[model samples]
Target chain A: MSIFFSLFAGLGLFFIGIRLVSNNLRQVIGRRLRQLIARAVTGAGSLALFGLLAGAVMQSVNAVIHVLVSLVTAGAMDRKRAFPIIRWANIGTSLLVLVAAIDLHALALCLVGLTGIAYYQQIDQSTRWRHAVGALLGLGLLFLGTDFIKSGAALLRTEPWLRLHISELGLWLLPSFAIGAAVAWVAQSSTTVVVITMSLAAGGLISWNGGTMLVMGAGLGSAVSAWNLAGRLQGSARQLVLFQVLLRLQGLLLTFIFYACNRWLLDDPFNRLLDHFQLGLPARFAAFYMVVQLLSDLGSRTLEKPSLRWLEAWAAPSLQENLSKPHFVHDEALDEAETALLLADKEQQRLLACLPAYLDALRQDAPAALASADKRQAAESQVLQLCEQFLVELADRQRSRDVLERSMVLRDRNRLLGSLQESLAELHQSTRAVMSDPTVAQLLDHLVQSLHIVLETLAETAALAQPDAEELELLRSLTHDRSDLMDSIRRRLQGSDLEPGLRQAVFSATTVFERCVWLARRYVLLLDGPAASPDHPK
Target chain B: MSFEHDINDEQGTRLVSLKGRIDSATASAFEQATQDLFATPNARALLDFSAVDYISSAGLRVVLMAAKRAKQAQGRLLLCGMRQHVREVFEISGFLQIIDSVADRSEGLRQLNA
Candidate 1:
């Protein structure tokens, strides 16, 4: 019972340690990490490598990928890039096995002391160093961890009905593996299992055959633990992890076959080379086990892509669209209204891109382009249709309190986009009406030129993930000019001696321009999101 | 803009019609519309969207600021005939959630005011 309690304590500590490290790191650098990774990761292969490297660096790619997945689902990244980045993340993920397998068989006390001291101090470096040291200390604990495991095995050996069957190396390996895998899975730490296996073997408490089997079991058991944790999260994530495990399991099966064929292959010629050496049984066992782990880790990630692709094909539709950063964010999900809002926004923006081209075609009277304009029109039709669908769904939802408010915002935004077709028609009519008046016509033409520049900037703004400061300032300036024009038009309307018809007409034209400006600002606000926008462009 | 809504014995039925621009200068019109409904016996009103063409922050304010007014009156306001320009103004400002909207006066008058 005491032993079981100690084992539980050890496992509890392991979970707490990983959680502490991951949480603090996230607090210190969570939001920026996504931006950084997005900026850094480009090519698919490299992105995958980045994912792996990030996981290795953070000691938890699971956490980083969670952030990435959230951003991606929020319509943040190019789909093509997201796919590749996710694929390569596995490359770095495989390295954890290597981290767990390393023999940190010394300096456990110093690690704990340093970590304690670092945590006590409030300096920034100390805190950062504390996490790093805690990880190292955790790595160092693996050393004493092995000692504890050996002690456990020693205690087990003394028990009266202890079951230690002596059989061929491969035969005994399966049972050893079964025990090891179960231990690692339950403990949620392959490191603990590996060290425990090593300690017992080194202490002469378990045979090399048993030790080797535990190592093999550790490989299989890891997926069990990972899949278990994966199931707790969302998206196609659990499915993706399961798919990844299938690939790893295939490697395990292959390794198991090699274990069976070991005697045949490593017989006399292999025996003679080792026979001359005075290597300890424990040392030889550790070396052989390490070799197996490295090969499996490297080979599984690299070679299993094709198989994973096949698995992914089966797995794609199986993934849930939870839109969460599964590993990090637990409950941060957009409600149906929000989901609809974002989807509608994206679809609307996509539709908006067609406006310039269509307007240009109409201006040039390009009949051929009218066919393409029809495509744009169809796109707009799709946007409006989607908006209605989203609105209908939004209407039906019983959202949470704050999100309810956000829902209103989304609904409003959708309706705002809905006004486009008719508003554009009015603008076109107003332009034609005002253009007929000789005095304002040239000014209107010039203003349209300027408006086009402003709109070009707006379009450029539309194209940009983030607009440049100078361009943003220019946009503000254009809006300011538009507002000024509004003021001037009002001033002109107020002048008493003017023709009543022209006065009304001028007033009407100003209103149309003002409306256009207003809508443009609204859509622009949508693009900038709810972030604080600078008042007016330069 | 000043707004008015009136709904009948359909319980949640009412109609609100407007008469001015909706901005800082004329935001009171919008407020008066909701306030006038609140002063009435009806618990529901359809907002006559035909007259209201422009909306600004101040206009949106009256809609949001008087949220408790309709509920206190045991009534609600449903917006109707929200021309695209007006609807876009509401949307960009995020007014869709606070007030119920319909295609026309009849629909607003019939839809649930609550």
Candidate 2:
């Protein structure tokens, strides 16, 4: 009972230590880590290497995945580029397992001792080193937990009941494999499960063959955990999760094949290779774990293109995801300020073109192919955010006065576009709210129709490479201040026998419409260039 | 409400007279009624909206589409005889700035001839 208690406590401590290390390390690295990941698009080899380093430093592939998912969601990194990094990160996690195979009692105590000293001196309170201290403490706890589990497992080796149960379970590989998988699925970490199996095998409580099966089971279990975690995710985010699952299955298959070869035709070639190194049971199991991850990585790479196509087809991108991604702007363009500004300008034009889609639901004759207004609005907001980030990044880089001035103009237009989208969205909502009222139905119809027309016109004007003066003048006339017109409508509604709620709805709709027109006019003026923009001076 | 159109040629101009409500149900027929005018390059037409009592956004879209088609074909489209409510729709939409309009048919013909 005491031995079981020690093992349970050690497992709990191990889980907590891994969580603390991953969370604090992420905080310590902060935005710089994300920036590095975002810019690591040079090649697959470099990205894979970076993933390996990230996995080793973070000590958990799950943490690395969370980071990748956010970067992909923010449009900072491409999902295709992230695939290799995810696969390589799996192999990188083996570093901890390998380190655990060796005795680290002294190092673990030293880490804990230093952390205690830091806490006693209030050094852990310092902002600069706080996360670092937390990470070190987590590492110390991790090592201490492993030592406790190992010692507890060794003690359990002498228990008659435990020895009999293990001996019976080891006879049939299925039970051992099932137990390992169940524990790993519950724990949400395959490495943790495999480490426990390694400790058991080293204590002579489980045979080497049973330990290998358990390790393979752990890999499969973690993949299942990943699938559940990604149940709510869609599009490319879901694709990453599928990739993780496929890689784990591949690893499991490869390990099974090797096990079969050794058991049948090959006459234990794998065990012979390990025997040549004279490694202990724990070290051999660690080697087995590394090999499984390596095989998974290598196999997945071989099938990368086909796998990506399948994943994409299975988890097709949503309209919102498609809209959120910037089609014209590339981070690489930031190096050349002029090119960066030009690309951003093109992206902004695309955004302008998307404005009319917000009224799709209100359009009686709207094309069936158009996405819902809600999806369009959400996508537009995301695209706007990405554009803003790109412009900010461009501004930070070294650039000449001319390029800087152009970037500033684009930034100002970007802000106006954001405001225009918000107003239109509000207008759409307000218009929908008043559509059912008999007194305002006709007016609402007219408002929706007219706004749609103006938005379509603005989109057309934006698409032009160099809009003629007539087009500019037309936009100006269309978007001119309509406060008086809105006011007149309000006065007329106020005098009529209408509910106050309906009247307020009309008022809100018209005000938003007026704001939309004004913002559209300002956006067009900016498009005309700073010199021609009277309302927005350079 | 039901809508109908009558088309005829007067010298070099196509004269189309539209009647009744031009809402969603009738906007498509209205568009189909004037498609031939834009099919011919540089075609000139005068659309008389005097008989049309009401026009919705869909109706406005058809009119806007005609105007764009006319411009693309390097032709001219002139609107006249629009009722007060009908004219307000175009005014609020800013279509008046781009599409040529007159108060009556005779003025539309005179402008087209000019």
lDDT of 2: 0.79
- Alpha-carbon local distance difference test for all models: 0.52, 0.79
Give the clashing residue pairs of candidate 2, or none: none
RMSD of candidate 1 to true structure, Å: 21.0
lDDT of 2 by residue, A215-288 (tens): 98888888888787579789988898889988888888888887787788787878888999999998899998
Q: A406, model 2: CA deviation in Å?
A: 2.6
> Candidate 2: deviation at residue A407, Å?
2.5
Q: How well is each residue in A169-191 modelled by candidate 1, as lDDT tens digits?
A: 33566677888788767655454
Against the hidden true structure, what lDDT does model 1 obtain?
Answer: 0.52
TM (B chain), model 1:
0.72
Q: Give lDDT: candidate 2, residue A218.
A: 87
Which candidate wins on TM-score?
Answer: 2
Interface RMSD of each: 14.1, 2.6
Model 2 error, position A409 (Å): 2.3
What would the TM-scores of all predictions be?
A: 0.42, 0.81
